[model samples]
Target chain A: MLDDVVFWVLAVVAVAAGVAVFRVDSMARATYALAVSFVAVGLVLLLFDLQFLGVITVLMMVMEMAIMAIYMIMFMGMNPALMPMSMVHAKRPSLAVAVVTFVVLASGAVLIPWPSRRGAPASDLTVSLGQALMGSKMLVMMTVSAVLFATIIGALVLAVPRGRYDRLGDDLRGRVDADQPDGAGQ
Target chain B: MTLQTVLLVAAALFSVGLYGAISQQVVVMVMMGLELMLNAVVLAAGGFWWFLSPAPDGQVLLLVVITAMTVEMAMGFAVATLLHRTRNEDMTDMATDLAQ
Candidate 1:
């Protein structure tokens, strides 16, 4: 009984926040909303007894949003959260496509006949997951990890323009502090 | 009521997010859209886990997905920051200059 209530409440919150991610006018606001939505979903995952995934989701999103906030501050030079900049563009086509996709997918979800239970249920679900992943999907996991590493390297190369010595001088004892080149960093 | 309902909800959320990614001009908005899709993936994984059985594998896959989301967002921010440095604007359309 309580589970049903919790599930519905969470589902509503998650979906609402997901909508807010697009509805909000500013970039920072949308990012925060998305973060909230993910956290809510993480909680729902917990309610479903997926403890490992739920906790990881919360941790991961918090860190991701914090990093995003930093970049917003560093780049936009305004409170990206408060700005009323319109993030939307090309709205009519987007809305049409989104609605059509939703209808088809939702219809399938409601109408399709899913596979029913077969064979005896496993006593330990986590163990079953481990066995399946290790047995069949091990390569997939490795590929994902490798891709993540490459992304990190690529980001670093793009973001950092030059080493510390380039700006601070060879001895790192330059008067570049409080000095503005082209009046940047204001 | 059933797994299909949950999966449908996930699918709707994913499509909505995809639209946002395609429609938004700002980099941050695009990232928000990506996060939305990742959230849907999490939901789908959970639904599979529950309906399939009590196996912890769905949960584990979700853990990996969450981790991937984090790494991707971090790198995305770094790229955005770089772009902002080169050009003071955050709109994707303004990022076309590739020359010194």
Candidate 2:
């Protein structure tokens, strides 16, 4: 009974914070609201016995929100994100669509005849998960690693305003570029 | 703790995200909407694994989802930076020229 209560409370917090993301005026508030929503969902995952995912979710989301706040402040020209501004557009149609989607999904959740569990859970979930990653799912893990590396490189390439060529000169042997900002270079 | 209740919560979260994604004018706000939607997916997947499958594969799937969310958000920030630098615009409506 206590578990159910906790789950419901987290669920409410998650959904309410999600709603607040758009309702809030400032971009920082919206970003932190989404972070709160993710943290609540992470707690719900913990309730479901997904320890690694729950903890990772909390950590990753908090970090992501912090980075997002930095980007919002940095990228938003004229300090618009810092000022109070309307965050939404075409609100009526969006509301209608969201309402319809929720109704359909909720009805399906209540009406569908779900399958029963066929077997019990593993005694040591983390051990089994590690074994699976090192065993049958090794290929998937490798691919994901590659993808993550590529994402890091790709995002950096896109985000950096000046390339190495510009910083290092044609021969790539410049000690420090004149245009380089302080504390930005090694 | 029942599947129905968990799913209902997911549905609510997803719908709110949908609203934000569709209605938000700012690029980062839209990304936040997308993240919220993925957050709902994570919750629903955890519920499914706990109540139905109870396997390592489900956990792996959640991990992949989280990784994808991270990758997508990173790329989104990069793209937003590029757009702002090149066009000096952040609103979706201002980028309509890209559709041409």
Candidate 3:
């Protein structure tokens, strides 16, 4: 009973917020609404007994939205959250396409007959997951980790304005300030 | 709802998100669209686990997708910062220099 209640509530909230994400006038409001939606869905996943995935989903979206907020502040620097701006560019055509696509895909989803379980669930579901992941999917996991690492390094390189050379002289500390030209800092 | 219903909802969400991603002008909106798409994928995984597999592996895959979303957001933000510094605009209309 509780699961059903949670599922319906979350499902409603997710759909509503997902739509509001595009409908909102302000960028910040949309970002937070989207985050809330994702977090709600994550909680629903937890209700399904997928504790690890649920927890990660909530954490991941919170952090991602926070970073997006920071970017909005730094780049737009005009509180795109408070101000109303039309984020949409090509409206009528995009709207038509979006509607058609949603109809076709949703139809496929309703029409398809999902498969049933072939066997009983593993005795220790978590342990089985870990074994399966490590036994066969270790390479994919490693690749993702490496990709994240590279992204961090690349982002650092791009976002930071000055390096060690700007703070300190080549030899040592000398109240140094490199007067770099525009478009040459990075 | 049943697994089929859950999947149908997920697919709808995914398609909506994809449409937004392809058509949205603002980069941040595009990113939000991407997040929505990822959310749909996660829902499908969870539904599969609940109805078809009932195992933790499907759940783990969903967790990995969450992690990937975080990474994508972080990288996107950093690039946005760089672009802002180079050009005083955030709209995709002004970003046509790359195409030119």
What are the RMSD figures for all models against the true structure? 5.1, 2.7, 3.9
Instruction: Tell me each candidate's i-RMS in Å.
Output: 2.8, 1.0, 2.1
Residue runs of model 1 more than 4 Å from their true location after superposition: A118-141, A163-186, B53-57, B96-100
* Residue B54 CA displacement from its true place in model 3, Å: 2.8
Q: Native contact fraction of candidate 3?
A: 0.65
Candidate 2's residue-wise lDDT over B1-100, tens digit each? Answer: 7999999999999999999899988888889989999999999998899989998999899989999999989999999999999888888888878999
Tens digits of per-residue lDDT, candidate 1, A140-179, equal 6777678888887888777777645566678976555546
| lDDT (10s digit) by residue, model 2, range A91-130 | 9999999999999999999999989875777887878878
Docking class of 2: high
Runs off by more than 4 Å, candidate 2 = A77-82, A165-186
Q: List DockQ, one per candidate, in order.
A: 0.56, 0.84, 0.64
Highest lDDT among the candidates is held by which one? Answer: 2
lDDT value for model 2: 0.89
- Per-candidate TM equals 0.80, 0.92, 0.86
